[model samples]
Target: MLTVYAYQKCSTCRDALKWLRDRGIPHEVKAIRETPPTVAELESVLSGTGGDIRKLFNTSGVDYRELGMKDKLPTMDQAAALELLSSNGNLVKRPFVTGDGKTLVGFKESDWAAALG
Candidate 1:
């Protein structure tokens, strides 16, 4: 089963969940704001995105802006960045899904279909 870390208030998260349900894809949903992904999971996503750590972030989020991640990210090392993200779920992208050796960020229907299918 896939594990999806999503915020309830996020429309994108809702959409992703709906898509999964519509397809009958087995998955577990966790509130991203309360339970962020672990470093290991983040690492998997990092690897999946070809070592682009920025892809793992919710760059448009308030937390991202307030924390100055955009300016700070370039100077931060992988370990430090992952630690910060793991500690604060708000900094993570919505609809973070991981399972079956696959990792996906955000809610792109086509991407999800291709990955989960």
Candidate 2:
């Protein structure tokens, strides 16, 4: 089953949810702000995403800037990055979805269709 980690107020998350429903895709939604994914889960996401750890971050979020992750990303290791993300679910990317060994960080209808297909 597809698992979606999302924030309630995020438009992207809402869009993704709508997209999934419209497509009749089966998915389980989790409130990321209330319960963040674990390091192991993040690692799995990174691995399935072809090692693009940056894709796992909410780059446009306030948490990203407040933590100075933009400037410190280059120096961070996977473990450190996961630690930061775990500290605050808002720091992690929105509408994070995974299923059948596939990981998607954001809502892209075309991409999701292809992946699900």
Candidate 3:
């Protein structure tokens, strides 16, 4: 089963969950704001993103802007970045899905279909 970390108030997250339900995909949902992904999980997603640590972040989130992540991210190392993400769920992108050796962030219908279908 897939594990999806999502913020309940986020429309994107809701859409992703709906998509999963509509497709009959088996998954468990965790509130991203309450329980961020573990470091290991983040690392797995980072690897899937071709080692682009930035891709794992919710760049457009309020926390990102308030914390100035855009300016600070370029200088942070991978471990530091992952630690921050693991500690703060709001900094993670919505609908973070991982399972079955696949990792995905955000919601792109085609991408999800290709990966989960």
Candidate 4:
């Protein structure tokens, strides 16, 4: 089953949900703020995404900026990055979806369609 980690107030997340429904894809949605993903889960996502952990981060978010990740990302280790992401759900990308051994961050309609197809 597909698991979607999303923030309720995020328009992108809402759009992603709509896209999933439109495509008749079944998914389980979890409120990111209420239930942050674990390190293991993040590891899976990172691996599935070919180790582009930066893509899994909410780079533009206040939490990210406040945490000084913008300047520190290039120097941080994977473990440190994952720790920061796990510390604050808002610092992670929205609409993080994983299933069928595939992990996707953010929502691009074409990308999602291709994945689902």
True-vs-predicted CA distance for residue 85, candidate 3, Å: 0.1
C-alpha lDDT (0 to 100) for residue 90 of candidate 2: 90
Instruction: Rank candidates, TM-score, best first.
Output: 1, 3, 4, 2
Sequence-dependent TM-score of model 4: 0.92
Model 1 residue runs over 4 Å out of place are: none
Steric overlap count per candidate: 0, 0, 0, 0
| Candidate 4: segments with Cα more than 4 A from true spot | none
Worst-scoring 10-residue span by lDDT in model 2:
96-105
Lowest summed lDDT window (length 10), candidate 3: 93-102
lDDT of 2 by residue, 8-103 (tens): 999999998999898898899999988888787788888867888899999999988988988999889888999878778998898887777777
lDDT of each: 0.94, 0.86, 0.94, 0.87
Candidate 3: regions farther than 4 A off: none
Q: What are the per-residue Cα lDDT tens digits for candidate 1 across 1-117?
A: 899999999999999999999999999999998999999999999998999999999999999999999999999999999999999999999889999888999999999989988
Query: How well does model 1 score by local distance difference test?
Result: 0.94
Error of 4 at 62 (Å): 0.9
